[model samples]
Target: MCARIIRSLLVVCASLAVAANASAGQVQVAVAANFTAPMQAIASEFEKDTGHSVQASYGATGQFYAQISNGAPFEVFLSADDSTPAKLEKEGQSVEGSRFTYAIGKLVLWSPKEGVVDDKGAVLEKGDFKHLSIANPKAAPYGLAATQTLDKLGLSDTLKGKIVEGQNITQALQFVSTGNAELGLVALSQVYKDGQITAGSVWVVPEAMYQPIRQDALILKKGADNPAAEALVEYLKGPKAAEIIKAYGYTL
Candidate 1:
């Protein structure tokens, strides 16, 4: 009698597991490097609430655009700049009317070592550092903003030889964290938490110095029929994701 009851319980559990698996879906996402932390947190919450899983690939937005254009399998894209998604929509690479601004990014000049950067960002003009890191301006919007800030401050030509370029914003932060570069111009979301810089010294770049970094999210053409893709897009615009984005210091 005991063995029979145990077997029956096992069968019921298996059936329930199968039902759960049948309902759950997965979405592939291409994310910008700067938004990695918040996206991961949001993805976790999204999965818990919706029973859907997210597979995220992080990199420069320009590179992701090229890949998506060439038919990459990503169902959704969270770009570092609004212009990239606009271009994709214009070229028919993304689902029509599915794009929206998700977050506005902030740039910062930071050093992992305390006191290396000042609140006023006078370090660039002081020229006390050997290597200053930034993302590749051609591929990363934050890099373009950094350049713009430098130009506005009249320090671009003066600091050219001292600059070291990273492939993306994350790598640019790494260069500073690892001591390879004494200072880096990187996305604020990379180091901020709870309305403060989590580590090191930082100078938050003023918005007037550069173009606003308007990050956008959209479903790709390939994701038109994927329910998980549509769900994830809506989730990003929901209250839960907005809280997470704000906690990471991104303006939603």
Candidate 2:
């Protein structure tokens, strides 16, 4: 009698497990390169907690916008700047009420070699570096911020010849990390972890130098009815995700 009861319990547990697996869903997410680390961590946690999986693609906001406009299969977008998502909403590409600010990004001038960048960002005026990397201002918001900072300091023309443009912020940072450029203006979150910079030297650009980097998230029209998309959106706004975002040096 005891063996029969145990077997029955095992059968019921197996059924429950099968049901859970059957209901699991997957959401395709297009994420800004700068938010790559935090989003990866959050996605892992979301899957574990909710039994849904996230398939994420990282790239520049402008590039993603162009792709989405061309009918890409992405269901959700985590943009580096709020304007892109807002523009998508205006264009009817994303769900109107699904937009919200997820994080505020900070721009940083960084170099892999210690002491290459000063705290006050005077390195630009010095003009001693061979190459200074920045993302394509036309495609990356952080690139725009970098240009604005140089403009505010009246160094844009002086540094114009030294500027090397990357396709995106990740590539911009790569230029610095790989010694293709001595330094780069990139997202703080890329090099920051555990409440501090991960390596090298950095100067956090003053917020006043450029417009606020209000990163926003939105569910695209394709994801309007997707349970995984909705769940991922709510998970991003929850405390666990907020903690991870903050830990990566972003403002909630």
Candidate 3:
């Protein structure tokens, strides 16, 4: 009787260990640079609410897309534009029909110097600044939006010589914040807090100036079988995640 009881206890312990190991597995995510802060916030809450952890790599969405196509081991992708995920799904790199818009982002022309940027973004027209930084239009969705806005305003040709391009939106913002550039076109969420600009002058570009930045999230083919990745994707669409995203100046 005693031997049977001990064997039953060992079996239960082994099963419990397996379950714990599965719950502790991490989800690997590739996130766009523009969504850096929000993704960090979301990842923290996700890890706390669920025992699953997330390891996130942040960079330009275009670069991530290229990496994914080349078989990057990311389980999830949070993009700065909806198109990239849709393209990935079409290419069969992402789980079929597993992509969805997580947030809508805003573009802003910003200057760290007080009064350097105006509400109407006339600074771009004035062209007084020595340098204007923007992300590489070919590699970043926000950069593409900035390029579109400049084209819409007929400043593309005029501003060509004065433009300095960064690899990603985060780098573009760094150029402005560090005074490497007098002004920059960057993500609004990076400079906003409590419905206001934080320590900078910002012109929130009108939506009509460029295409809407509909950010999307996708479950990659590598993560289709990962429970943690699927749970994180669902969490991003939940009420808690929406609140956090909205707090960062993003729209649902």
Candidate 4:
């Protein structure tokens, strides 16, 4: 009887997945730049598992928030900070009660050159590097955290001239990766994953150096009636997606 029940449950689950695919189409997602890699992986797996496609646009979370406020046709938003989604929900731009924390991001001070940045983040004080890249503090959550970190270290003013700002974290990473900047304050997921540094050297910033970066996701008003959008959002909360996210070095 137990074997029969298990078989029946499998059939039901398969039927549900098929039905979901038949009913939904493609979901347009606005994702924070820091989450680009993992979201791409998650989207690919989600398409394979459920046959629902995702079209993702990655940029600074604040820029996406502004665009959404001005009627961007994004079906869903994956913000780098929790407050943006909450504000959208309050403004009726997103589906109420649809906001949920998806990842807890970690900040890192990274340098493409090995051993250039120590674990204690003493590189900033050394000031030997010609340039330090950071995302636009006014527009990116990671940038804001970088700003707070610099302030906490009392280097905000002293390092002003050495700083180069990128429009988003992706660009900031590019600045450092291509040797345009000696180092950068970037998202940890961008440089490290699966318990190893993907490239270069890194100083993982202490959590107390800045505010918690609790990233969140929400179904936008434009996606309220989109079955694909809702399905994609739900899929992100599933174990498969969580595994992908954690593999990228983000905490659940």
lDDT of 1: 0.94
The best candidate in terms of lDDT? 1
**lDDT, model 3, position 132:** 90
Query: By descending TM-score, how would the candidates be arranged?
Result: 2, 1, 3, 4
RMSD after Cα superposition, model 2: 0.8
Against the reference, the lDDT scores of all candidates come to 0.94, 0.94, 0.92, 0.93
lDDT of 3: 0.92
Per-residue error for 33 in candidate 4, Å, reads: 0.1
lDDT of 2: 0.94
lDDT of 3 by residue, 32-145 (tens): 999898889889999888889999999999999889988899999999999999898988888887899999999999998788888899999999988999999999999999
lDDT of 1 by residue, 93-124 (tens): 98999999999999999999899899999999
Model 2, 8-53: lDDT tens per residue? 9999999999999999999999999898899999999999999999
lDDT of 4 by residue, 4-119 (tens): 99999999999997887687589899999999999999999988876879999999988998899888899999999998888898988988888999999999999988889998
Cα RMSD to native, each candidate? 1.7, 0.8, 3.8, 5.4
Q: Give the TM-score of candidate 1.
A: 0.95
Give the TM-scores of the predictions, in the order they appear: 0.95, 0.98, 0.92, 0.91
* True lDDT of residue 71, candidate 2: 97
Q: Which stretches of candidate 4 lie over 4 Å from their true place?
A: 1-22
Give the 10-residue window scoring lowest on summed lDDT in candidate 4.
17-26
Off by over 4 Å in 1: 1-13
